[model samples]
Target: MPLADWLDRRTGWRSLAARARADLSRPVPRHVNALFALGTVAGTFLAVQVATGVLLLFHYRASADAAHGSLEALLSEVPSGWFVRSLHAWGAHLFVATLLLHMARVFVYGGYKRPRELTWILGSVLLLLGLGFAFTGSVLPWDQRAYWATTVGTRMAEAAPLVGEELLRLVRGGEEVGEATLGRMFALHVAVLPLALLPVLGAHLWLVRRLGVSTLEDADVEERVGHARLCEGGEPFFPHHVLQEAFVANLALGLLFLLAILAPAGLGPRADPLETPPGVRPEWYFLPVYQLQKYMPRSLLGIEGNTLGFLASIPPVLLLLALPFLDRSPARAPSRRKGAMALGLLVLGLGGALGVLGYLSNRTVQAFGRTFVFDDRGFPERAAGPATEPR
Candidate 1:
């Protein structure tokens, strides 16, 4: 108590605490429930990732020759190193998942309209950056999956119209995914991307603070000069809202540890440039796009399939970036925005279906008391009987 008093006298701890409490006590919409705390959940996972990543970095090697071995050493030779590494790996996937869910929640509420436009833009950028983190982090291990997945990803990059080759070379840091490529991915994963994300995240939070949380009642409406729509007749955010966020955060943390303990991240064989593994694939998030490519012809209407796919994706992305501007309906209710919601649902449903098929590629699976074989293109044919399990 004496030390606490002295510290408070010297550092103004009491004032700081008071200020924090006051800031957090601001009123938020009564409807801002635990579902609205997904962004906070995402931020928590990002913190977990950064902390665990720093611990892993102490033992990690960035070169192709030593990278996989270093990870093995970390898992086997170091104290609680497996926990740290597992948390880092598991946290990355959870981070991406939470970010996607947060975006979906925002979409459902039409949280991208009007004055929150810039916030939505920053969020979209954060989504891409999150995916970048996943890809580059995957390549850091320099294991079989990492190597082959990176190879697939880089080859896919070559589908870009004019700058494809240049982008591929830049990404790989050379002609192929060798030591230089590993080094580049390491730098991007640990340094460049983190630095990029921090500022964007800061700006995003600042915008959230400046504008306050968007509620269902005001998303697509024009801002009025004197009206305070954000917090009108709302509940205090400190106890009511913060408690919900804390609860969700704890649940998410529990899930992360459960996953780490039950199924820790494992490395495959060290990367072999001479050997290509069977059934190599990218992460689940990219599976839909990759699986779509498998179903398409090599060339379509005088255009390469890859190039056409790349071209087709640009319009959606452009449209997404310009959504707040384009969808100016002045109505946020889902019923009024039926067409937009329907389109979004269709895309999400299709992507989920494709991702499921991608995971079952050319393999026989049993479900609902039946067996079916999925082709490389993800189409299913009825199996003769239940497939035998491989030893």
Candidate 2:
């Protein structure tokens, strides 16, 4: 067979797949019409992160003593290295933001319903894994801030009840943060988690292909039919959609490069295992969880109440994982599901409130070993003191 003929046959098969997908009784929505774009945006960022991270690996040393210094050197000495680091940092934030928005869009549009349960479950797992990536990566800088923040974070895990101690040990690889801890985190951040995510992501995309895109149930079916009539018909996935994806991915990469060059991030002082920094806080993504730990009551059922707090995450996690099954109703539009809409609003409201409280709580400055008092107007006032003699 001629090479041209084989190429033509392969192209024909792909076109058939694209056409069949488009001609479904309800075609998978695209661009502004669905959450697919956000997922694509996230995937693009992930690719950026992986690429930049690999470059960083060339300069990074996994040892606790050298990791922080090596990163500093990369930012200061390695050519265009700062840009790479900044892009990785900012890209992580963008990836998480886009992913959350994508999930929210899916939930609101009823994409989790019926045959798409596995898709939703996989997305939830992806969300959690993204968080894990953020947490592990943050510690790699090994700065004073990162160290103390991780200390606070792992302490929260240690408050997790019966298995808390064991979990902490597993993560720390010992009684404390040391070489083993750094090595484990480096392995997880660069290799293990990403490897685990690939197959799941593939399955998620495959499911999306199989089940088709969920559409807005309230959209006028007749109007859609009329619009379809006026269209020039669908284009092939290869040249059209695939080209757009490549453009978007390139744009993301360019932005990352610009960030890495223009606003190269800096490392703070190296971690001192014996010292605790004041106002220690985890990465911004973790603020809500850390704040949740703070608000948990002192005790429950004769156990530390934070254990209950940790356990409370179970229901939400399960709900997120099982969303596809729970939302089995035929409704596919936000306006059609009042209960789900209300629940979504409630979750958003709670998250916003917790985030605000977390920021405010961390802003409370302590001085002289006493709780710093604030005035009624929310400003710190010097505790009433004797008038000082003129200096």
Scored by lDDT, the top model is: 1
Per residue, candidate 1 scores C-alpha lDDT tens digits across 1-391 of 9998999999999999999898878888667888898999999999999999999889998888899999999999999888998899999999999999998998888888777889999998998999999999999888899999999988877888788899889888888989988998889899999999999999999998777787667543436532255567788778888888999999999999999988999988989999999888889988887777766568888888888877766776676678888887767778889988997898799889889888888777777656788778777876657655556
| Model 1 TM-score relative to the real fold | 0.92
Over 4 Å off, model 2 = 1-35, 218-262, 364-391
Off by over 4 Å in 1: 1-21, 219-222, 225-230, 367-371, 381-386, 389-391
* Candidate 2 lDDT tens digits, 7-83: 86878766876676665434223433323567788898988889889999999999998998899899899987887
Error of 2 at 332 (Å): 1.5
Candidate 1 local Cα displacement, residue 72, angstroms: 0.4
The clash number for model 2 is 3
As for model 1, its CA RMSD to the true structure in angstroms is: 2.6
| Cα error, candidate 2, residue 67 (Å) | 0.4
**Cα lDDT, model 2, residue 18:** 67
